[model samples]
Target: MILPFFVYGTLRPGERNHDLFLRGRTLGEEPGRLRGVTLYEGPGYPYAVEEPDGAVSGELVTALPEAYPGLLTALDRLEEYVPGDPRNLYERVVKEVVRDADRAVVRAWVYVAAPAVAARLRARGTPVGGGEWRERR
Candidate 1:
């Protein structure tokens, strides 16, 4: 549907992956929040796991029309996401994100931890308190 992307962790602005992947490719980036997910620490990154009581702070990134296709593919690769693949680390899904600027609800693509990864994280992964990857300490 070419929806915008909700990025947390290293994909957010000023993060390592931002420059490598999103820089110069997006039309706009703004603060947003994804409800029903918790942020957990992963190897050199962070994963967002579905949790009814949690909310994740991140950015809503709208890619330039021409960049959308490539950006989508690149992100899927970066997140190690393969549709319906059991071994995938993350699964790209569409969700509603609340834009911090206007409190508007926008549908966007979010890469959440895959089923198995989410389960494992739920069992033992360290959650980034406050739901902000950058604020984890």
Candidate 2:
């Protein structure tokens, strides 16, 4: 079975790296929100925080199984999503993201960052929102 992942960070569509990752191969993307997580931005990509009362809002992007491996490597090269090291920010893993307005669930891939890294990024005081990634007219 395909695993569920939440793409609250840069992996969401229309971001800086969207064309490199999810442009042609993307199955679909839908507006999704997950509670207990918030956005944290750094000099580059955004991070996700698992706060008790926080929530993360982004898209649910489904990709083909064959394309996922390459996508992972690309993300790793971009955001440096690593396997080990607790302090390492942006760990790519399967996460449950809401589909169809919380009524249905689907398998997706998400990159979650460590809280410490997120905290540091927050301290830097950068704007946090998916809109910032978009090109303004």
Candidate number achieving the greatest lDDT relative to the actual structure: 1
- Candidate 1 all-Cα RMSD: 0.6
Q: Which ten residues in a row have the lowest lDDT in candidate 2?
A: 128-137
For all the candidates, what are their Cα RMSDs to the real structure? 0.6, 3.5
TM-score of candidate 1 on Cα atoms, chains taken together: 0.98
lDDT for each residue of candidate 2 in 61-106, tens digit (9 for 90 to 100): 7666777667666766676666786756666666666675765765
Cα error of candidate 1 at position 116, Å = 0.5
Could you estimate the TM-score for every candidate? 0.98, 0.73
Candidate 2 lDDT (Cα, whole model)? 0.63
Question: On a 0 to 100 scale, what is the lDDT of residue 136 in model 1?
Answer: 74
| Per-residue lDDT of 1 in model 2 | 41
